[model samples]
Target: MNTKLPKLEPITSEWMFKFINNYELQESLFKSYESPINIHSLDAFSRNIKEYQEILATYNFNSKIFFARKANKFQNLITAAVANGIGVDTASYEELKQCIDLQVSSDKLISTAAIKSRKLLELAIKNKVLLVIDNQDELDQVAQIAREYNIKAKIGIRISGFYYEGNKLLSRFGFDIDDIENLLQNYFTEANEHLFNIEGFHFHLDGYSTSQRGESIHQTLDLIENLNSSKTSFKFIDIGGGILMNYLRHQNEWNLFKTELQDAVLENREPLTYNNDGLGYTNRNGQIEGDLATYPYYNENSKASFLKEILDTTNDSSKAVYQRLEQLNIELRLEPGRSLLNQVGITAARVAHRKVDARGNHLIGLEMNMSQMKSSSADFLLDPFVSYNNPIKEAEPVEVYFTGAYCLERDILLKRKIELPQLPEIGDTIIFVNTAGYMMHFFETEAHLFKRAQNLSVLGRKEHYTFDDFKTE
Candidate 1:
């Protein structure tokens, strides 16, 4: 059956397109580093940073962009981000220590780890990097560590339970917004102020809604104002990252795919996804229920514009969020992970085998595992670039699902069935672009003792690019 699949072509950077088109370079790198290698471009990363900085520079309020380190674990990118005049938002002891060891100044780093250990607290206090406390337990831990070191640990309290449009948004990460004032009154007394220095408030919302975020900002501002006093003055409000970034080139394609997916789920058409996976859609008594659970891949307003929208969010009665920040001289801080790493890296893997599965579905086996390129989304929706080992040979068009190295039955690399001009041969290269954010190394593992993919940072794209141009540990 010849199937016509919807294409989600990704927006690529110059370096990414160059590397994708360079078959010789890919062959050479795969030959040297073996199959399943991730290549990142520092230049693309820096350019993304500059875009955000330029957008923020237009505003009057002081601002800082902290690169969330949990997005990608590359040390090179972390150091490069700080060198570009941004801070690093470390989430763990290792993440914090690495930044400190790299000589990242205390001001350029913040520890926002969900679970803070004693050692993590000690390290953050020693380095004087801001620690975003989740609860009173964390606060007490920081206080103990500060007393031991005889220095106040600068910290921020994370607030949640934001009410937007008369509904409260719930999150397990931070203190409830309603109780923040009470918590402050109890903990941040004049005597206890010496133990912990309150820097500001922080929050991370799940979805990409500008109005909700703007309302969140208004609520946080109100809390800051209510709690403002002689011993307490907030300097910044961190609307933590969940900034949207566009991935697909066409909106019609995304729309069509969604329609087709629903139809496929309802058994009204052929399955677009492997095994007719619902992807959060369910047939509840012959009616479609639940929305697509995947990331909204086709964003109309993303990155800087998305941020601007949030800042410009205000009703007629109140000032814009940014204007209020300007009036109060509050530094607007954001920690962007995926958007910052946009077009910065791609993961390449060689085809290991091609076969027909038990259910008569064509499966292309890749050298890598699902975790190597997996995200929290239902699927990585973008079409992969293929580098055929032999393009001269004539072949038939084939539609196949890419499988991974894991032994489990559900280790399908991509849930979507992709149509190719020809069946991929053994040792052919499959390049998944724009995977630097959470796709590359977020959940990579060594289950069954398979060696992890090597991560190499591509220094520059030149005419005679050699292995020396790629940096690998």
Candidate 2:
């Protein structure tokens, strides 16, 4: 049977289209490389940082924006953060050391790793970077280190309130609400208050629910109010970043596609071959039930304006976050990872060849593998744009699945089949946009000696690009 696939349009800026469509630039970049390459725009990165700063400036209370360093491993991004005088949020020893070595001020760093080593704790204490305490054991370890060095451990207690779906706390990163009193009594005594310093509280969740974030802030505020008798002084409330990034332009189309996919799957349609059982749903008592792991590819609230909504949001009792922060005299600290890196980079690969599969589905093979673009998400839902060195006018549009050079049959670069305006030819470029976030390097690998994709910085009006190898290592 013939199946009609759902089409997704990516949300992009005009400059991105112009930059990718520049035939001369594409020719120069693809001249030497036979594989994939990641082209990052430093200008875009600067614009995103400035936007966040502008948003934070709108509030009367003191606020800080910390670029979550684990989002992308590119050193240039970290350098940009330091140059702009913004803070950097690191999670590993190497990430922390890299920022310090790059001359990022010690005060402008925060370590929030779930598991930190003794050496990392020592380095953090020595450099005066803020350490977000995860648990009591880790807190004790930090206290010991601080005592050994004759310094107070600068810390913020990470706490978890109620999570979504009325479920138990989803994150394993923070302290439970009930544990706060015991913690304060045990650690904030006259004897040990000199050993550790409680600066504030922090909480991070997986989803980008503004209401939930506001609730967390309220819960943290209540916790602080209860600790008024304790010697611990709180200064900031770090609602760790879960800002949403919009990848798809049309929400209605996205929903329509999901419905069509389910219908097609249940109807046992043919001719549409999907990797991994065609979207994977569960059936129980004639009812289809399963949580398909899909991203909010088309969110109404995006990185550009979500912060405004968050700050303006009111709790169920109608208390605004800005008002709460103003009343508490507490600073707002944010550690955005993917949201900050949105629209800052793209991944391009040269089409090695094209052919028809055994099931008559058209297939286009690229020199790169799924690892280059894979993140924690099950699949990247946005459709990749095609950039041609030489334009071709086809009588009919051709639909095909993009495959990779990996030996495994499961190595599909894009699980969703895409339709190209014309049949792709050798040396043509397949471009994935807005990938500067975790998608660029999180799950990247040098498997099969592919040497991994080289990262190039598009500098100065996109006129010149340079390969920055040292940033990755």
Candidate 3:
């Protein structure tokens, strides 16, 4: 309600926003498979996986794409990734068991939690997945387990580096570079040759900006060089994923398009005017909606280029001064949690109620909460549209703020002034765009007066959905 809703039409100019509307695309893909509902189109996930891999390889970095099972933990994604030969990274007992159930080979899975339960740790060890041990005590404990089992365990020592953002990373999750070096040279592997075979280094970071990752890798590169000179090992570097989705990048670059589309949503119209198969968005009033060109950003390079550029900077000898160690051959792995699921998904909810607040503000409370969506972070801006993709029946823009099912005022999802098609009726399904990542189901509890939302994944062109995967008990 902060900004007045504008005329709400697509930009009449050059490329800015290339909408990746995954929900509309999925409906069409799910047509081929019978239990299409049982499977979702992980095609986007597959696309990002390879694209990111090749980007790393461009910088002469070895690539191992590990799917962070924590993001969605959807069986469909797991099945598709395992079948595609992608490695899986699990953080819990259920995730571990899920791997077994999905028949994901133990070799393809890695157990990486800064802190884990004994049962979970033992379960991971028993399953033979690479265990990323955190903290000194756990390292000692893992060393003990390696000795007790008489099996040589492949390990990655996570290094807690300083944040380029200048925020102190005091989380008790990783070893300082000095500590990892000392343990590497003095104790860990020596304490139990049967157990700890530290193969690489891993670190988890926040968000998708590439500079942070490059900085961490830069430091890790130095660590690898010094450690290799002193000791004689190290092979992999796990840069935990927070890469920006292509659609997200599009929104940022095409700020003008998104701004207009943001206005159009409430007005119930197109974001572009298209002809000759180009993706249509905003246009003149009563403009024909067909023949819009496919919004092209990913293939031609938008955000991916930024990511690749960051990786490319490593070639600058001045930055990666550890040239000899760079030759040791290391596979760069990314555990992307968000980019993989872009647009291929949607969260549906019936409007719970409509009420007018003190300032004559109309508030539509949805059944689910906004905290579920990860991309809508402090910096995660959302340009959501009604995902139906059909022509809009209502044309007037509805200017209102949204509240969640929870009673707390802070439980709201969209804090910004969003433009939705005028006067959405109670019980009408509201779809939040680009929510396929962490938005669908991260913070669901049967707290307060609200009920949990149902999660469904779309498969091929049939637009079929698999429900009940996230139905609360």
Candidate 4:
């Protein structure tokens, strides 16, 4: 391992440690399932769910946690979520259909697709799953489908234009809160009541800000209060998920990385990332500019404590947000995709080849593609474990970049240059910890006719897991 590098070591689960340490098992699986493989554990996922449940219990508020299915496409995790007394939040027709096929109850399935299609609306109406209407067109389609089915389709109106800290949060989705009066007067008419059952108000924000969440809840609460009457009422507030989760083990490491990255971008030090790409920073005439585009991998408060911070936010009347929900008998609903999958999965791939680029940089090729382990972030910051297949000989330390199987020049697996005590031999396994959320399959593809990585759900201890314990995809 390179001790001189500003390292962001991962805070891994016991399952990850056990699995990565077992070279024999990893090698056997690689041989069986091909090079790159994704392994998941329900233990961490279930534990995360219980933590949220426990925290909500402390507030004495009726809460619902829906596992956002868009984060990962693993069906086993969806089934596991329903079994744990939670629900599934799907964003597409196939996701909703698969959940229903898995026999998830109507109350435990919700459709929050950004672009709702007629087929999706029909399925959601038939299954009675709550469909969050984004705009008037979508609401009209859903209403028409409900009328065709001769049933009241359960619905939640997605609200946007929430004011946070003096700025109106802009988003293309959802109806403007300023137009709520007009919306209620026109679209939500008495005739529409027979075609729609307004269950609640829903909103999804982009960034992670506790204050913004608090302000949104306060605003939504005001809307529900003003709109509630003999004719209509809301039972829940679905805050679509942006809950943060910590990945790195040390805050100082993340801090040092930022400083070093700025120095590298300013030409004060050697390149930290491959080609000194700066992740998201730019050298603007001897000054670094642009915000870091990666996820905040090191958080002091996350998961349950993160939720607690929002619930503890006080309204204008000095009542806590949770207290308001409790007094109003409102269900505080969240669709957390990444946080619930924290520490739940890892990606493993085999070393393919090694070479030196024209720029004199060392490159080690892996059997996996960049899309197999990628997200919207500029790069994944956690360091990976190299499971060497052979014994260590007298070797010198080397710093190299990991490359992927794609033919494109931008197919670098990890932007940061990794330092190792020695160069890995062919067939050595490189394991990326805590990748179950958006890293493993969010943007994966089958380009170049390369088969997609296989997924396996594992159970039991490292020493006790058998082939039979794996739920294959």
Best by TM-score: 4
**Can you give the TM-score per candidate against the true fold?**
0.97, 0.92, 0.73, 0.98
Q: Go through the candidates in order and give each one's C-alpha lDDT.
A: 0.88, 0.79, 0.57, 0.89
List candidate 2 segments past 4 Å from native.
32-34, 163-168, 268-273, 276-280, 283-286, 315-317, 460-473
* lDDT of predicted model 2: 0.79
Clashing pairs in 1: none
Could you give candidate 3's per-residue lDDT for residues 320-438 as a string of tens digits? Answer: 52232356677677676666665545444546678888866678786566555433333124445443334367577766666775567665555444567766665444555555566
- Tens-digit lDDT track of model 4 for 1-473: 12367778899887787777778888788878998999999888899999999998888879999999899988789888988999999999999999888889999999999988899999999988999999899888888888887989999999999987788999998999899878988988987889999989999999999888998999999888888854788999999899999999999999999988888888888888987898899999999999889999999989888899999888879988998999888999999999999999999999899999998878999999999999999999999988887747788878889999999989999999888778888888889999999999999999999999999998656665555667785
Query: Which residue pairs clash in candidate 4?
Result: none
Question: Is 1 or 3 the stronger prediction by TM-score?
Answer: 1
Mind sharing the TM-score for model 2? 0.92
Candidate 4 or 1, higher TM-score: 4
After TM-score superposition, what is the CA distance of residue 406 in candidate 2 from its true location, in Å? Answer: 2.1
Give per-residue CA lDDT, model 1, range 387-443, as digits (tens). Answer: 886875678878889999899988998899888888889988898999998998899
Question: Candidate 1 has what TM-score?
Answer: 0.97
The best candidate by lDDT is 4
Worst 10 residues of 1 by lDDT: 1-10
